[model samples]
Target chain A: MPVEKLIFYAFAALMLFAAVRVISVRNSVQAVLFLVLTFFCAAVLWMLAEAEFLAITLVLVYVGAVMVLFLFVVMMLDVDYAAMREGFARLLPFGIIVSLMFFGVLFYILRDRFFGPENLPPPPPHGADYSNVEALGEVLYTEYFYPFEIAAVLLLVAMVAAISLTFRGRQQRKGQQVSRQLQAQKSDRLKIVTMASESPRKATPEPAPTDPEEGQS
Target chain B: MDALLAVLLIIGKILLILIPLILAVAYTTFAERKLIGYMQMRIGPNRVGIRGWLQPIADVIKLLLKEIVIPSGASKGLFVIAPILFIAPSFAAWAVVPFDAGVVLADVNVGLLYLLAMTSIGVYGVIIAGWASNSKYAFLGSLRSAAQIISYEIAMGFALVAVLMAGGSMNLGEIVEAQSGGIWHWFFLPLLPILVVYWVSGVAETNRAPFDLPEGESEIVAGFHVEYAGMAFALFFLAEYANMILISVLTALFFFGGWLNPLQGIPGLETITAWIPGTIWLLLKAGFFLFLMIWLRATFPRYRYDQVMRLGWKIFIPVTLVWLFVLTLMIKGGLPPWFGEAG
Candidate 1:
């Protein structure tokens, strides 16, 4: 077998195994890690298929940023395994139905009529100088510009929504104003009052008549 | 046999890169110590060898000989894997780092992106180590480190985007070639703000001071690696140092014109310095940045956690974004001398 073929097979096998493990793992952290592995394997598969730009972007965006945040939240959560498992049996049938429906839809879309080799032959391979980034950028900027812009705007909106949802108004919180602190001058913090130096006073002897009444008492 | 020869040849090239890189990392530690020591009016580790030249070697041997102690309740598999996971990406990122003109392991078109991805993946090691250790200090340290890394990554990415816009290519070699004329033609002159953001973010990303709040000794003991000992702990140290060197090298490559002679445009100096190798120039540039890293460590106090976050998210990100906008305008308007031909 060709080296590429071998690599593809290995990554494919790993992806499948990781995907299975993601569902099967009891530990939330481990499950998230398995999912990450699955994504990584998928990215490698994409690389093998000569989609280097997409492959790296997938790793960069999903595995690097999104999944790190996912793992962060999952790791921090104090999950009750017993409570989580309680509804598994009750939800199994519903889950099976939903997944089956989803699979059926995918099958309908990806059936031989639409996606077979006869209908859609593989793309011709480009030369060594061919840049996936440039090609993708050309198409994205020219052909699908409006859609791309719309998607970007949608993401912006989502980001804004998330922030706004979480943002509490600045209640009378004592937050550090770093700029103000940095701009502070010596005079603002310390005032050196210039005064005449006080002369040391010698201890005076008490007069005998000052406490005459007390002594008499 | 031909295929086998090719594989061996590739392996040889990798070793050529890795050997020097590992040595550089080791020496960076030595340099950091000696430099910091000098700053504080003291000599560091002179007992190991002459002027402490063999200090890193001794440290390495000691670490190797020591037993890797696992905490009683620590997750065994992950505890072992975490350091490897962290160190692997730092090494892997070297694959695309060009030393001289066209001297790279894998000159992939998406080299910059690949580096970004690889570096970002390193946070997992810290997170995993923290979680597996089952120690509050470790967990808190990792969380802080990971959050810091993620925040800084955005600013770093934006800075790289500015570089990409200015250079007109993702290939590191191509980026260097674009700045061929002289130091004046380098992206650093036009993208000064971006360069500052990139270098600062790079420092933060590596968890170095003044951004080294992740390993804040006073607060979290040893941070994420609190439970780690011996070789395992050494791996984290290795990864951090390796990352520091990588960032320095990358800053050189992106801004200082990697492997390009700085005296190129100067008439007499150019001819005089012609005998000097490009790799040396690259090293010198990277070495200066490395010195700066240590210098900063010695000079500055560690940033408070909130301040570090504010600097990354509020300050650096916005700076990069504004600079990126300005760079885009410069590129579009064909601004003279630096970016006239960039469009």
Candidate 2:
């Protein structure tokens, strides 16, 4: 086989292993890490398919941002493994049925009858100067412009919703007013108070000492 | 046989970049020490051979000779793998960096995106190391570092978006070529605010001083790598320094014009400086940024954790977003500086 084929196979194998481990791993942290590995391998596979833009974006978005947050939460949570495992036996039948149904759907859609090489031949390779980013951008901006804009708006709305849901205004809560802090001047912080120096005190006359002789006697 | 030769050639090219990079990383540590020392009025690392030039080598040797002590409760596999993970992306990102005109390892079209992705991947090493160490300090440090990196990454991404708008290309080489005329044509002047945001966010992203709250020694006692010792610890150090160099080089590449001569338009100096190689110019710019990084470490105090977050999220992000808007207008309106420029 060619080098590209070999690479694809290697990454595909690794991705499969990682995907399996993501669910099977005993430790949640390890599971998350495995998921990251799976995403990375999938990205490599995408790169092999000449989808460099999509591949890099996948690594950039999913593996980079999303998975890091996932790992962050997973690592912080004080999960009880014993408690989590207690439901495994009870959930197994339902889980197996659901997974099987999902797999069947995927297999049916991906069957040779529809997605065979006869029906859809491999795309002709582009020349060296062909830019995946430019091509993708062209399509995204023109043909799918409305859909893209809608998706972006949807994400923005979701973000606003998330922020608003979490946000609360409390009178007692104190927070850093960064702008006010930055606006503070030296004069505002310090006042140079000047006062007249008064030092001299009036001298009082001393009484004559008569106790020394009497004490000695 | 042809395949073998090609593979060997690629390996040779990789080494050509990697060897110099590793050496540069080592010297950057020495430079940081010496620069910061001079700034603070102290003699830095003059004990080793010939004014302590051999200090980095000696330190490496010492680290290599010492044992990697894994803590009792530490996850052995992850503890071992964490340093590797940390350092791998630091080196891997170099694959996309344009040294001179057309002088790059990969030269991928999405080079900037690749660099961003690699840097993002680096946070995992810290998180894993902290978690695996089973120490509170390590975990806290990792959490802080991860959060800081994630927050700053958005600002950094926005800064790069401005660069993309100014340059009109994602390719680093193309971006450099876009600013070929002179210093006036560079992205720094037009994208001044963006550059500032990028530079600051770069520092924060790399977890350098002033933004080095993640490894705040006084508070977290060395943070995420607290339990790491010897070579394992050295790996993290190497990764940090490597990342610092990468960020500096990227700052040069994105804003200052990678491999492009600054004195291009100058009549007298242009011909005189033309003899100098592009690689040398690139290195000089990178070196200046590196020195500035050390200077920053010396000059500024570590920002409070909240302050760092506020600066990244509230300040830098807004600055970049506004600048990006301005940049978009410029690009659309065909204004001066980068107007009618090919990328």
Candidate 3:
């Protein structure tokens, strides 16, 4: 077998193993870690497909940022292991049936009739100094420019929406505007203290008795 | 038989070089201290090994003799692997960095790209160390480093692209060859903006002072390597210094003509220094840049996190990009007269 095929099989095996571990792991943190492994293996497969830039982006963006955030969330969450496992068995049969059905459908669609017996297509002889990123940039700008701009707009809109939703004013919590605070003069927080003279003497007064038949007046 | 013998010779040479390289890295620390100390009004190490020339060796012995204490909660395997991983790539990148016309160990077509990839992978070691240590400080430091490297990588790549455009090749040797003839032919004059951007990005890339927030002492408490000690800490230090040298070499190679005589338009001086070896010139140029780097570290203060990002994205990237476009146009049109009639 070719080296490419060996790498393909290795990465494929890694992905499957990682996916299985992700589902079966008791610890949520370990599950997220397994997911990262799965992403890494996928990135390797993408690299084998001659998508070096995309592969690196996947690692840098997804594995670097998304998985880190996932790990943070998973670690911070107060999860009860017993409670999480409560309905797992009850849901297993149906979940497996649904997943197996989806897998069968996917396999059937990707069978010999669909993909044919075509071997791995040999990559074109790359130019001496050509970069995948450069090619992608050219294509994106020339052909897909409008769609790219549209997608950017959509992302911007979504980002704005998310920020707005999360940034609602709350009456209970005190929030400081850093810009305003930075601009604040020291005089605003400062005060001058002065001492006044104290009174020299004070008198005590006796209380009149009123109880026990008017203090036997 | 010849190929086998050649391989053996190469391997032997690597071994010889590796031992000395390690020793050189050890003393580089001492040199840095003494140099910085001299620059300031302070006395550096003088007790160990005759004016502290052997201070690096003494320091190495001390680090080696010291016991490596593992934190109770740390991941033992990854914690051990991290420093080695970090240092290995730093040394590996030097494999392709040409010292002279034919002195490089490997001269692959994708030499520059390979360097980039190797340096990029270097971050994983840092990230792993931070994660494995399970320390908040380490984790924060690593996170900051990751962001910093990734952000500046874009600007650095742009700056490099400008160099590539000017040189018309990604091969370092070819780049050096292109800059032959004179100082005016150096890419620094034509691509001045890019050179500045590249140099600044190089500083950030090396995680040096002013951009060394990843290891900010006052804030994150020594940053990512907070937990590292003994030889492990030494390895990280070695990697950092090695990276600094690598960046300086790259700066020299790209902006200043690598191994080329700096006498352009001056007929007498050019002819005189034409006989001087290229390696010496290259070393001198690289050394000058290294000194400048140290000088910058000594002089400037660290930038805040936001400021670092702002400088990279807002200032460097756009500057490099526009300069790249300008250079591409200039090179495409024709060489300027000052480029000295193109060999």
Candidate 4:
């Protein structure tokens, strides 16, 4: 086998291990990290397959933005490991059966190409100078334009809905409106109050618990 | 056998790039101190070596000799890996940075995206470090860093899209080459506002001062790397400074025309400008940006956390989005001067 094939196999094995670890890991944070590893290895595989744009996008989007948020949320969650582990055995058979069934379906789809002579030959490879990004862009904008536009619209709707649902103001805590905070000029907060100077006269001569010198402050 | 030799050659090339990068980071720390010191009316780092030249080396040795104290409650594995993860992408992003014409490790077509991708990976280090530290300060710092990066990346991406639109290429080399005629032909001339947005976003993305909420020493105390000690802390320090330099280099590349002299036209001046090497021009531009960073730190007060958020999401996103739309219209309209290079 060529060195290329060796690298491919290494990536594949790493990806598989990471994917497994994603579910198998006891710690949620650990699980998410493993998932990131899975995404990273998958990106490398995509690189091997010569889909540089998609591969970089995978790293940029999934491993970068998405997983950071995932880790953020998972860390905030207070998980009871012992309680989670107690249910693991009960869920094992179901998990195994479901995964097995899914794999079986995948095998069923791929069996013809994998077992027999390659019925579907690989697509013609693009030249080194061919921009994967440009090709993908052309397809996304031209051929699948409608679906792409719809998907974009759907994401926009989801984003708006998420914001509206979660970002509404509540009366309980005096929430910091960042805009209000930022817009406030120093003049608004820092008032140079003019008053007559009194000779050591306290506003309230209440007895202090600790030090009498505190009243001067 | 040929492949083996090729791998060895590539490794050597990688080392060539990395050594300079490591040295750059070392000296950047020194420069930041000295520059800021000059601004603050204080003499900086004249002790270690001549004009504090060996301060970075001394700092490194000190950090190396210092004991790494892992917090008892901290997650061991992630704690160990966080600094490595944080620092790796800072170096890795340099692979696609075109120092001069045809001078890059991997001349991938999606070079810009590759840089973006690698830089994006920098957050993982902070997040992991914060998480593994098991300290509130670290966690808060990580969250802040993550949120800040994610929010700013959008504006930065849109700003870059404008650059791509103008340059008509995603490749860094081509982007620089496209702005070939002169400083006036540069993308920054056309996409000035977008460049500003991108620069600000870059500052925020790198977690620099005025937007350095992630490392709020007054409150969170070193932020994400709160629990890190010895070389781990050093790694984070290195990564931060590396990222600063990366941003500076990128600013030089994307907007200022990488490695290209400012004066391309106007007879008699061309002789003066042309003599300066392209690589030197690039370094000078990058250095200026680096100096600007230090200047900003000295000049501006650190922005409040919410203020930083407001600046990013509220102020910048809207500005960049509107600018992006305007550019798109210009391209469609075939407007001259406005829609010149990209359109």
Report backbone clashes per prediction. 0, 0, 0, 0
Grade the docking of candidate 2. Answer: medium
The lDDT, on a scale of 0 to 1, for candidate 2 is 0.90
Report the C-alpha lDDT of model 1 over B122-239, residue by residue, as the tens digit.
9999999999999999999999999999999999999999888888999999999988898898878898998889999999999898888889998899899999888899889989
**Clash pairs detected, candidate 2:** none
Q: What is candidate 1's CA lDDT for residue A3?
A: 81
Candidate 2 regions exceeding 4 Å error are A193-217, B341-343
For model 3 the local lDDT of residue B159 reads: 82
Q: Write the number of the candidate with greater lDDT, choosing between 3 and 4.
A: 4
Who is ahead in TM-score, 2 or 4? 2
lDDT digits (tens) for residues A54-120 of candidate 1 = 9999999999999999999999899999998999999999999999999999999999999998999
The residue pairs found clashing in candidate 1 are none
DockQ of each: 0.77, 0.77, 0.08, 0.76
Tens-digit lDDT string for candidate 2 (B254-290): 9998899999999999999999999898989999999
Name the better of 3 and 4 by DockQ: 4
Question: lDDT, candidate 3, residue B41?
Answer: 81
Better of 1 and 4 by TM-score: 1
True contacts kept of each: 0.82, 0.86, 0.00, 1.00
Best by lDDT: 1
iRMS of candidate 4, Å:
0.7
lDDT of each: 0.91, 0.90, 0.80, 0.89
lDDT of 1: 0.91
Write the residue-wise lDDT of candidate 4 on B177-214 in tens digits.
Answer: 88887777777866888989999999999999989899
lDDT of 2 by residue, A1-217 (tens): 3989999889999999999999889999999999999999999999988899999999999999999999988887999999888988899999999999999999999999999889999899988789999999999999999999999999999999999898885667578687898899999989998864532321332365466763343
Candidate 3 lDDT, B261-324, residue by residue in tens: 7875597887777788887788788888888888888899899898898789888988987887
